[model samples]
Target: MKSKNYDYYLIILTSLILLAIGLVCIYGIIYYNFLAVKPEWSSLYAEYIEIMNSYLYPFLVLLLISLGLCIPKRLLGQDILIKSSALILGATLVLTVIFNLEAGLGFILAVMIGIQSMVLIMTFRKSRAVRFEKHGYVVRLGSSLLHLGLVVLIFNFVTLRESPSHILIFWTGTLLITAGTIFALYPDRITRLWYTEQ
Candidate 1:
């Protein structure tokens, strides 16, 4: 029992630490890749930066909510968190589908929100009692969905602007999406060969 409790603590602590690192990296991406290249708000880069900035709150909320669940909790709170996460993701995914089909002002928003939804959905699913759950499951699945969505979105965005450079982004995004999906779907098999007797 003590060992199991210790394992739980380790998992939560590790997750928290990684979450912090991811937040920093996200901010760095915004700061260095987006904000640093701009006349502030005049270009697509600016729009991307602004959109990423919007994710700060959601990311923080997710981290906090995950922390809440990492501790002992009443069933009500767990249910609330689980359902709310799912709802948020589901709503965003629906919006993404709408945006993808409609051709409108919210293309970027749709893509980003879609990615967010994918992440939240996978996170919620992993937090459940699935024997298949593991460290990379949620992130890999979410990233795969996000990558695939971005491939299409970026292709459209770049094509609309008549740019050739973005083709690299498209290919890389597809590769990442494919790799992530492979990992998410077959993590146990992939890692099994790496295992040695404990």
Candidate 2:
């Protein structure tokens, strides 16, 4: 019996579920605050809800890009997917750097961009590997890039906060520990073994 080609189905189902969850989270956050106040004095609620909705925009973009990554069955080759994903990741990284000037909002946006880029890159690599029937160096580089991006994200969150010196010290330690784990696990354990010769 032949195995089923369910990759596209899986991707679509997963993306839809994720999108729904994100939308629900945004709605709940806005509605929870909306319900806690009286209508007469809650005119600012509209602005608050809009601001909350803005946060879900990145997640929506991510969901769409993930769907785009599932195009191998429709396309003739994997090259298109890999190149397009890399281009998207590069463009998003540039935008992330440009938006790095602010604190909480900027940090969240930057991290979201980084995470989306990682997902795109990984999907691209996975498709390319399936086409070529061999593992390559791109996956290793993608893993490293993801780990570095996560460390930067953590640092961005820490430095954005206005806290006492003691808290800063604690955050510094936390960042170090997290970065160390990424370094040890990403190249040596997690992604490295995934691409090892079978």
- Which candidate comes out best when scored by lDDT? 2
Q: Write the per-residue lDDT of candidate 1 for residues 23-122, one digit (tens) a residue.
A: 7676767666655566664556666655654554344434323432332221124455457555644564465457532232233334344444445455
Taking every candidate in turn, the Cα RMSD to the unseen true structure, in Å, is 17.2, 16.2
lDDT of 2 by residue, 58-151 (tens): 5544543453344232232456665765565566556556763233334444544454455436545564433311134444344334434444
Q: What is the lDDT of residue 54 in candidate 1?
A: 51
TM-score of each: 0.31, 0.36
Record all residue pairs in model 1 with backbone atoms less than 3 Å apart, i.e. clashing. none
The 10 consecutive residues of candidate 1 with the worst lDDT sum are 67-76
Record all residue pairs in model 2 with backbone atoms less than 3 Å apart, i.e. clashing: none
Model number with the top TM-score: 2
Model 1 ranges off by over 4 Å: 1-114, 117-161, 193-198
